[model samples]
Target: MNLQPDARRALGAGLVVIALVAFSNSSAHISDVGQQAAVAAVSSTDTLTQLNQSLISANKDKGVLKEGELLEKAVHRKALMEILAKENPAHFLRYVLNASQISSLPKSVTATVEKRISTEGVIDTYIIDDFEHPEKSHYEYYFKRGANVKSLYLVGDLLVRSNTQALITGYEGDTYVVADNTKGNVTIKANKDIDGGSNEALGVQNTAVILVDFDDSGPRPFTKEQAKNIFFNAQFNKFMKEQSYNKVSFKGDVYGWYRLSGPSMSNGQHVIPVFGNDNSQLNRIILENNIPIGNYGRVIIAINSDFTSSSQVGMTMQYIGGREYFFSSSWISLAGFDILAPFPFTWTDLDFLLAHELGHALGLMHANSWECG
Candidate 1:
């Protein structure tokens, strides 16, 4: 039909207006409903949650959001994470958007970022892990690198996205170098050092001697060789190097083993064993004159079968300056090996017990779970 131009334009305009009205009405309703759902879901608790978000928003520190303004309890938790989206978008973008857990993950590793990278954008998923000690006898872990992950911390290992130029800075209490990353994977264990210099990262490069002097009055379970082997094993050597003494790293050397010859040495302790001692003593002693205390920083371990941990297991102590430092050990000879009892013991256990004593000598307290973890 031949119609006037103005009439045709007017008809189109009317239809456009009707469509605009419908869209605006629908959008307003949707937005209002979405906001209401969010408030209702979050208001159940006075505390806001740790965010689990999209790849771009994951790991960003959202300061503690307080729901106390409208929530049931009307109380706020401490503001823990304060990160600005504008200041560091890298962190902001990594903030968690969603989170969930699975029974299959290992406790040693904290979290994982699953990302598939392509030229267009990123598709990321995250899994929150269980940190409580494991219930299983053996567990497995897998380290997978993707575009979204920057750094991840495990029990004793740290995985960073970049693998190049991976040099270990000094590692001390509760920190270790699993793999120097020079060649490949490494085992994780306590008392293991993250040495900056050694190829194995085992510990100090040089060796310092700790001479053991046995008393003639007691039974000796270990021949000089056996005692030396116990203290010089990989575990003991690595543990010693990983430690700090006098506010400095025990960085210079591994402990050397020596057996004093000729006469048996006199035991120095204000207290006695079995009746009132725990297979241990103070690290420093007032030496009986006429006895030679070799070079400064030298430690002499005097072992006597007569000494016992009040007939139980363990004890430890520390000392002050040189004229030589000495420590005493009490033990019962067990089938070819000198042992600490009150429980089943092994060479590894012995290493741990003695290293703990060394820590006492170095002025460290017996660390509880809180401190070590």
Candidate 2:
């Protein structure tokens, strides 16, 4: 799949960085996002275009229609329609369904959703068939359901533009959370003291948050010199300790400082540092039609920074619980307290911030979702 620089740029810049790669173009099946370009060939055929037109004519809702053909070509029709009517048009459909949502989706659909989410931010379609390959497409995104699957949705009302891409700017969708009950009693450990309150503190009984200490070996925006002090500072230590408490006191499991960095991180995905391995490493296998992470209960958590401004002193949450973290930038935001607090722009509230988002990661929607409910 020799993606034209334009295509790669298009992918990196498009609201959804969909890799319209190459494949054998058989009876149309799902495809992976990665491959040797020369081996696979993308469809130049107007099949997607035709499909797009058909959907628009059939479903005229503004959100659906406004998304245009790109969506139809990239995702599934049913999912897009739902996102349009419920997420875009501001119509609450889940209220009619009465089902609690999960935070991560299946690996297959999630892969495609992540691609769209990486660029556009919100997903309305699933990548089912990949004309690029007989067995796969450049990627696959679709929605499927099962009794054993845990589904999560995130909804927000904002928009974001990253790397010249147009994102809906908020989050509103669902994911799957496989309860870690396989271990009979899952142990959650943290690195610091436990406050024993709040949802995060209470969640300690079934989860864990690791307190990490590193010499700054992985990915980050701040240079080594700038981040050195905070790495081992007392406040940082206290934070980690508290994080440990949050995990252990709450019966959560924690793995000490681990390493994370790969294409996604290099591509500008700002994930946080944690102790154990969520096997997010599998995410690096973009076009394989396989997912190593996003299993049943284990959700990947990353610590992001609020470097939007120098004065800004808070933590930002990246809920990759979706194929990507947020649907649109507006789906989540840093609270005012994070900014006004006396923390540095570094990982000051990494643990606490993670705690807040972990709540969302754990199938707990905001109080607002109840209103929406």
Candidate 3:
């Protein structure tokens, strides 16, 4: 056994998020009518016993090394030596071969020499008893120094004759580490997947709702009357529906457009905007001026005069858990303004933008895949 340390680590890491996939013990077979009975008549108890013993021994010796023990330079030789000598003799050859290389064995094991130190092999046996009763045993071994051990299972094969690949430049003794020699740009980063909700149903209480406010200094770009009129409009209402904004009920009265000078504040849709360079500045205005919505409640959009076009535009596209947003200007485009342009310019887009952004801010991402909505 003496499974590779890397394989043990990888398996442990994978189990943190997802359990291992169970391998099926019995595989389906398609054979001629007469073959079924003939194949069934074979006795594989002896072979199974041997294979089980080998697997047990291999499993026991696998990863008997402690952390910080260099896999190279025979650091784990003590643990491995004991297993090879006292545990299971059937798997003794597997450890010995993994340590170095096997010159010859039962013809069942076929070794395919890959580059210099790497070798790939497999052993497939079909045991037939009297009356031509047959049972098949398949083993694939990948022998690669310092390479991952889980890859062997993935490669599929037996303990002795499994297909394996060793990196010629693999580490020595117990450790296997290869040097990277690439000149190209290498990007190492985590992959992030978008979060979208189930589309099969919609609920009013569950719908995304966002309230936006640009801090008040005086009159905002739009008049307060103008903002309310837009929020009540029908076109914007349809847009929210498309973006998965279930139902929105104004939580507070519209405070007319106001000037943002020092800080931005948020009371649902009402905001006091403070002059700032970017979204961070906008965030500051809210943190400084606005009161927080309870842990579970409606969406709030806070706008500030201090927010520049760059800051607003940047905020429109970003995603945050349990929230969503849209800049007033960006809202126009996102609401399909061109389609609604023939109609009056109202606060509908603004309202819908709040709903959409809150959808994301709360925990939603666009589902461009679904056709229904």
TM-score list, all predictions: 0.25, 0.27, 0.26
Candidate 3, residues 259-295: lDDT per residue as tens digits?
A: 3344343453323232222354334433444424222
**lDDT tens digits, residues 339-373, model 1?**
43344533343453444433332322222222111
Model 3 quality (TM-score): 0.26
lDDT of 1: 0.26
Model 2 lDDT per residue over 56-92, tens place: 3434343434344434443563354333332212222
Worst 10 residues of 2 by lDDT: 307-316
Runs in model 3 with CA error above 4 Å?
1-219, 232-234, 238-292, 295-340, 343-362
Model 1 regions more than 4 Å off: 1-218, 242-298, 306-349
Which candidate leads in TM-score?
Answer: 2
